[model samples]
Target: MSGETVITRFAPSPTGRLHLGHAASAIRAHDYARERGGRFVLRIEDIDGTRSRPEFVAGILEDLAWLGLRWDLLVFQSERLAKYQAALETLKARGLVYPCFCTRAEIAASASAPQGDAAPVYPGICRDLTVEEVTARAHLAHCWRLDMAKAVAITGALAWHDAIAGAVVADPLAQGDVVLARKDAPASYHLAVTLDDAAQGVTDVVRGVDLFAATDVHRVLQALLGLPVPSYHHHPLVVDAAGRRLAKRDGALSLAEMREGGEDGATLAARVRGGDRLATSW
Candidate 1:
C-alpha cells in the first residue's frame, strides 16, 4: 500500500446500545487508523428515523468514549439527506434506478429461493415499469431501487481490493435491485454508506465479515457514481460462548451496562483487541 494516511470509520446505527460486537468493530477500526497515524471517524447511521433514537445516539457516543476509542471526525446520516438525493437523481437520469412499490410480504412471496444470510435478493418486479405505469405509481409511496443490470452494463467488470481476499470482482447481480431510497428514509444503507465513505475520504473500510458480500453492491455504486473505491478489511464477528453472534438483544453485554457495573474501559478494549475470549460473556 502507499504511504498515504489511511482513513477508517466506525459507523453504527443508533437503534440500540453499543454491544460487544459493536465494541470489537470499533476497536478494530480505531486501531487500524491509529497504527498508521491516520484518522478514525465515527458515523451515526440514523437513517431509519422510525427506529433511530436520540437516546441511542447519546449512548453510542458515551460508550465509544468509555471504550477509549477516539474519532477524528463525527458525521450523522440523518444530516446528509440532500447529498443522497442528488446521487439518486443522478442515477435516475442515467436510467439506473427505478421506483419499487413492493411491500415486505410481496417481496417475500416473489423470492424464488430460500432467503439467504442477507436480505432476500430483491426480484426485479419493478425494473421493467413503463413510463406511464411509473407515472401512475409515482403518487404512491415507493422506494428507489438501483437497476443492477443497467448499472453493471454501464460500468462493466468492476473489482475492489480487500486486505484478506485481495482483488475481488464485484458481483452486484446477486443482490438484484437494491433500494437506494425509501419513503420513510431518504437513503438506504447501500447508497448512504457508499457516498459517505467517498465524501469522508475513507481509504480503508474495516467492518464485520458479514458485510463482505454487500461490498459488491457498494463497489458497483462507486463505479456508477464515479466515486473512489476503498480497500476493505472484513474482520471476524464477536460471538458469545455458544458461538452465536453478539447482538443488541444481549443487553448484558452492552458497553453501558458494563460501565455501570464498574468495568474498566481500557480492560474491555484490550480484551476486544486480543480476540474472542473476552472476560465477560461475549
Candidate 2:
C-alpha cells in the first residue's frame, strides 16, 4: 500500500444504466477524496463480459462528468485478467485455494441453509477434497474456492479501519469458502474487488449501507491475500416514493430517463440530496 495521502475510487459496473443510487455513491466518493485533499479514481467494472455493455460505460462517464465529478485515473477491470490470475496462482501454490465441484442443486441439498439476504453459505464440501479426488470428480473445469481455515490460520483476525463505521473485524468461518475463480467467470466479485482495491492503492471505500454485511467477506479476503484494507463509509441509500431502493432496473428513475425528462445535472443532484440544492460550487 502507498500509505500516503487518501485515495478513493468510484467503481461502477457497466451492466446497467446509472441511477440515483449510483449518483449518491459517486458524489460521496468524489466529495470524500476532495475534502481530504486526496485523489479520486474512476474504475469501470466490466468483468462480466456478457452483461457489461459499452453504452452503459459511456453513459456512466457522461453522467459523472455532468455532475462535475472528476478522477485522477480511469481504469477498466476487463484489462486486468492477468493480475487476477497471478493472485489466484499465489493462493493455489500456498494451498489456500481448493476446487469445488458442488453443483447448485448439490449445494442446496446440504444439511443447513443460507440465512436471509445472504447467498447460501458454501457448505465447504470441497474444502477437504484432495487434489486427485477434486480433479477426478470434476467433469468440466470447476471453480476455485478459498480455503477459509488455512487463510484464517495464516492471518488471525481480519480487521480494517473504516471511515464511518470505525474499526471492523471479520470471521472467516462465517464467510466460509468464497469462490475465487469460476468456470464461467474468471474472478468472483469478492476476489476482484479486494485485488483491485489493493492494486489501486485505495484509502477509502464509500458505498450504500446495504452492503455492510458483505464488507466482512471483503475484509477476510484482504487478510487472506495479504492486502491492505481500506477504510469504509457506507452511506444511506436513495429510495423512491414507495421507500424502495432506486435501481437501474427501474427505467423511470434511471439517469437516462431523468435526462429525457428535462432534469439537468444540478436538478438531479438536488433531488438525490433530499430535494435541496447543493452549493453552486459543487
Candidate 3:
C-alpha cells in the first residue's frame, strides 16, 4: 500500500468496560495511523445481541474520547447484518458453504482432533446433506459453514503478510469449516470482520496477537470473496499484574474505574504510546 494512506482501526466488542489492555491496543491502532498521517476508525463489534449493551457502547466512546483519541469514522457491526448475510449467501450459492445442523454438543463430541486453543475443528458432518435433506430439517436451527476443501481448492494456495510475523501461508482447512453465520446470529466474526475491513478501506490492520491464527481463516475468506488484502500488524497482547493477558470476563479493572480513581487518561495513553509498562507498572 505504498503511497496509499495508512488506514487502521480498533474494533472492540461492547461487552464490558475498557481496561488498560484495551488502552494499549487502542493507542497502538490510533498511533499507527496518526503517525503515518492516515486515518483511524473505531468499529464496534457488537453482533452478539445477548451480551452487547448500549451503556457499554456509550462508555467506550467516552473512554476513548477521554484518552484524547479521535476517530475519523465510526462503524457498528450490528448495523451491517444484511451485508454479512449477502456475503454468506454468495458463498452458499457458489457451493463454498453449507448448512450445518449439528449442535455445539454434537460438534464437540465428533471432533477428530483439536486445533490448538480454538474450538474443536468441525468435522463437516452436515457437509453432504442433500437439498431435500436440508429442506427437511428446515425447522432445525443451523449455521453456515465454509466447505473448507472446496473453498481452498477454488482459491488454490493463498497467503497473507503480517508486519511482525512477515509472510505467512493461508491455512483455513486447519480450522475446518468455521461458522460463517447462524440463524440467531446472522453474522459471524470471521465473516463480518473480513467484510468490514475491506468495505471500510482498511489498509493496515493493528490488533493484539491473540488473533494471529484467526488471520489464516480470514485470508481464505478474503480470497474467496475477492477482497483486497490489507497488511497486518499483530502486536503483543497487554498483560496484567499476574503476567497473564487481561480479559473482561476475568473482571480486569477497567479504564473507567482508573479514570474515576484519578488516573490520567492522556498520561496512560502516552505511556502506552511510549511502550512504558504493560506488565507491572501500568
Candidate 4:
C-alpha cells in the first residue's frame, strides 16, 4: 500500500434517493480519498433491474453534486454485466459455483439461522444434489450459489485487514453457500462488487458497518477469482429517533428532500461525518 495512490469508492444502489446515511458514507469515502491526494470513484450499483430506476440515478447525481463532492471517475454496475458474467463463468469453470433450485419459501421455512438483510443462511439443500436430481429439476428456474465448503478447501485459510476492526480472519461458511448469480440478475452483489473493486483498483472500501459481514464473502470471492483484496473501513450506520438504522423503506429523510428544504448540503455532510446525530434530527 506504500506509495500506492489511495482509491476509495462510494457504491450506492439507485433503488432510492440518497439519504443522510448515504451522505455520511459518501463524505467518509470522499474525504478519505481527497485528504490523501487519491482518486474517489462514484459507482452506481444498479444491477438489480427490477428496483433500480433512472430517476433515482439522476437524483443521486444531483444530491452528490450538491454536496460539493466531485468524483474522479463514475461507474455503473449495470453496464458491466458482461464482465461479471465472465467472472462467474471463470468460477463455474473451476467448479466453484452450482445451480440452486430451492425457492424462497422452502429456504425460509427450512433455514434456522439467517445471516444478512433477512436472508437466511442457506442450509445447503441443493449443495449435493445428484446429476439426476439436477436434471429432474432442470425445467425449474434456479440461481447460482458458491460451494462454500469446497471453495474453502481450495483457498485454504483466508484473511484481510480492516481500517476499523484491525486484522480479521475470513469465515465465509458463516454465511453458507452464498449466491453468486440470480435468475433475473446476471451476478449477485457479493460477486459484482468484489470484482468491481479489484477492477477499478480500489485500495480502500468505506461503507456502513451493516456490510461488514458481507466482506467475508467478498474476501472469499476475491481469492477464488484471483482478485486483489482492498482495505475496508466500516463506519457506523445512521439511525433514526427510534435508534433503528435509516432505511429507504423506513422513510429515512432523503437528501433530495433536504436540498429542497434548504438544508445546507455541506453543513449536513460535515455534521454527519463528525458523528453528529443531530444532523439527521428533524
RMSD of 1: 1.4
Off by over 4 Å in 4: 113-117, 280-282
The lDDT of model 2 is 0.80
Q: List the residue pairs that clash in candidate 3.
A: none
- List the candidate 1 regions with Cα displacement exceeding 4 Å: 250-252
lDDT of 1 by residue, 168-278 (tens): 988889888888998799998899999999999999999999999899999999988889888999998888877878875544478888888899889888877877484
lDDT of 2 at 189: 83
lDDT (10s digit) by residue, model 3, range 187-241: 8889999999999999999989988989989999998898999999999988876
Q: What is candidate 4's local distance difference test score? A: 0.89
- Model 2, 77-125: lDDT tens digits are 9999999999999898898888887887777778385566456778888
| C-alpha RMSD by candidate, in order | 1.4, 3.6, 1.7, 1.6
| Per-model TM values vs. the true structure | 0.96, 0.89, 0.94, 0.96
Ten contiguous residues with the weakest lDDT in model 3: 273-282
When summed lDDT is taken over every stretch of 10 residues in candidate 4, the lowest stretch is 273-282
Candidate 4 per-residue lDDT, tens place, 1-282, comes to: 679999999999999888888888899999999999999999999989899999999999999998889999999998898998998899889888889998989999897765556788889999889889999998889999999998999888999888889999998888899999998789998999998999899999999899888999998888888889899999988788998888778878889888888899888877776687676542
| Whole-structure CA lDDT of model 1 | 0.89
Local distance difference test scores for all models: 0.89, 0.80, 0.88, 0.89
